[model samples]
Target: MPILSKETKAAILGAIHLKTESVDVPEWGDGVTILVSEMSGLARDAFYAKKEGGKVPISQSQADLLLATVVDETGALVLDESDVASLQAQGTAVLDRVVAVAVRLNGMQPAAVEDAVKNSAAAPSGDSGSSSASTSASQ
Candidate 1:
């Protein structure tokens, strides 16, 4: 195959390629459904950065992933960093249900999330600066 031109490559990279799914959360209310979208490469990177070496808590990690993946009809994120506390206050089962879908949609194994939750319980709590370093490097 002939090599693609720069413009073609740019167009491909700029396209909206993430997949989305509707999640049912009966616990929240009767027939309550939410939309979740697959994470973009940058979003996924930021997610892993926060959980790098399991420094962050499991609840925090789940909230961060939810904030990144949960979207509106237009694929824009519905939650922001300010909503982390509120998201954490939500039911664990509900969070896990949605987070599981986001993880699978983003190509992450369920086992990894389980391990992170387990490891985070024993992991220390503090800014190790690893995530900051990653963010800096990416920038």
Candidate 2:
């Protein structure tokens, strides 16, 4: 389901308490591994920290490290948008090259196929004229 929408943005922000002008740390102890909650909070905090100029613009390696750490330590999923965009760009490049080759190959198809089909359907005597002419020519 789509959770992010203009209408739900404010509610989401409110639910996460981003606009509450304060940070509240959830209680952590007693072997309670709130993995999802902690990782999600960390991700959210990282983003908001950048937005608030509390952190620098994350580099590619830094982003990778962050994603790896979150996924490894907390078993959380994370994606770097710019990394995804780069991968998509590379995929499109490959597709475009494939299409170019396909177009060229397709362009060579028509005449050879036409001739092959026509020749294959020809009579054993190779006569395509009138019936009388064909009979005389065959004999």
Candidate 3:
């Protein structure tokens, strides 16, 4: 409902590069196998490699673990709260940019996007209002 188009998702995924790869960890070893991308360590493959069927987002636990815990150079799980916060912030920022860019790329004006967000956030309770709003927005 919050304007989650494929282009938006794809932009975020492409920017995030959510994939399993090795990272450099000087403290433990040379490299560690973990779920990470070029940008941040947010595991999200389903969204990147989505097919025609449906979209499967990353689970909350997975994200928490990936961001909060990183495999050390010695293949040890290390919990770093600061790292978690940083990764979360980076992911959020990327998503925000992707949404903004995607909306513009989809031919939605700034005002229209604002209206769409408002409509989606607090849509009328009744079915009639919802239907009418949807019809109007589509036009």
Candidate 4:
């Protein structure tokens, strides 16, 4: 489902030349820095953050680590370095599933909040007759 492949991301990230710009951090301090094409950066960010796979949410730190890896090999950070290295060395797979649940919840919360607002707004203001009329309309 991703528009960009791993190779593509690596290539794009590699293509970036960081030497041209000074190492100035953004005011927001997002904890990741790289010099790459805007589109490629966006694509890689989206992919690493699991945005391409719907209902998946990645932590900012994880996203930063992924981006750092995608950008500069030296900039990469892996919390479970030994485990990941072992898995990679053995060709094993590691799946983190919580992101999907978080994404789903993130998507659902807004809709639920909106529905609650609408229902509250639709309810008649202290009028029993209107409430009964609305209830009867459903039946």
Candidate 5:
């Protein structure tokens, strides 16, 4: 294969390459459906960042993923940050089903999400004393 020029590489990187699928949700209502799309690299990175230091709650992580991947027919996001609480309030069965699709489309394993939740739950909330103790011990 010929080596791609800088312009060609730029064009390839700038193109829309994510995939979208329609997810059926009988639980929501008869004939209810939603458009789920693969998260872009940047979006995926940001999603993971939310889990960093275990600051984000498990429900918020799920809501964040939903907001990032659930889009409309025009490929625009259907939900925004303002809708996070509403999304979290949704039935867990339907929400998990949709989130599973988003996770698969984004090439993330279910274990990753489970692990994030576990880590977050185990993390100390606003407890800096542990760190200070470790620092003093080392010194």
Candidate 6:
């Protein structure tokens, strides 16, 4: 299960958080339909296109496409190093914004949560302190 090193996992998660992270998509963000259509260029259209007429790749073409498309961001289909660097910069900016928000939120400790955990833990078992036992159940 642990095939990759820590650095590799970080790189993989960083790239994923970059692309899948939500950002304004220009004029297409008006509605779901429009956004879907606009992003369709980066969707499975190429994969399906190959499947349509049996033009599918048989080797490293698949690997090359995966790296090029995700790193290009604009779907320009060019795999130049500068193109990838530009896309990477955009993604990293988004990631930095998200990480900053998380840091700010973690600093803002909610009193209710603190009270629940602190009071409960300081109290005794079966004495209402057990109420602080964390649970995943939903209402």
- Writing each residue's lDDT as its tens digit, candidate 4 over 1-139 gives 2234685777655554321111223432565343221123454354446544455323443333323332234432233333433323321111122222322322334676588679879987775654222333211
Best by lDDT: 1
Write model 3 residue lDDT over 8-91, tens digit each, in one string.
Answer: 776655542222334333333456234222223222233233323665343323334454324444434454545545444445
lDDT of 2 at 40: 42
Off by over 4 Å in 6: 1-42, 55-57, 60-64, 72-139
**Looking at model 2, which ten-residue stretch has the lowest summed lDDT?**
17-26
lDDT of each: 0.84, 0.38, 0.41, 0.36, 0.82, 0.37
Ranking by lDDT: 1, 5, 3, 2, 6, 4
TM per prediction? 0.69, 0.18, 0.22, 0.19, 0.68, 0.21
- Give lDDT: candidate 3, residue 25: 31
lDDT (Cα, tens digit) per residue for candidate 5, span 64-85? 9998999998888899999999
Q: After superposition, how far is residue 57 of candidate 4 from its true place, in Å?
A: 2.9
| True lDDT of residue 41, candidate 4 | 47
Write the residue-wise lDDT of candidate 2 on 1-139 in tens digits. 3255698778766653211111121322344321111234465446445546355433432343333222223244434555534423333343333333322332324676577568768746745566442233211
Candidate 1 regions exceeding 4 Å error are: 1-7, 110-139
> Which is superior by lDDT, 2 or 3?
3
Q: What's the C-alpha lDDT at position 139 in model 1?
A: 17
* Model 3: how far residue 136 lies from native, Å: 57
Q: Report residue 126 deviation for candidate 4 (angstroms).
A: 65
Quality of model 1 by C-alpha lDDT: 0.84
lDDT of 5: 0.82
C-alpha RMSD values across all candidates: 11.2, 26.5, 15.2, 18.5, 13.3, 19.0
List, residue by residue over 1-139, the lDDT tens digit for candidate 6.
2234685777655443222223343332464111001112344445335446545333333332333333234333334444434334444444344333322322213675477568768986655544454453420
TM-score-best of 2 and 5: 5
Model 1: per-residue Cα lDDT at residue 28: 79
Evaluate residue 20 in candidate 3 and report its C-alpha lDDT on the 0 to 100 scale: 33
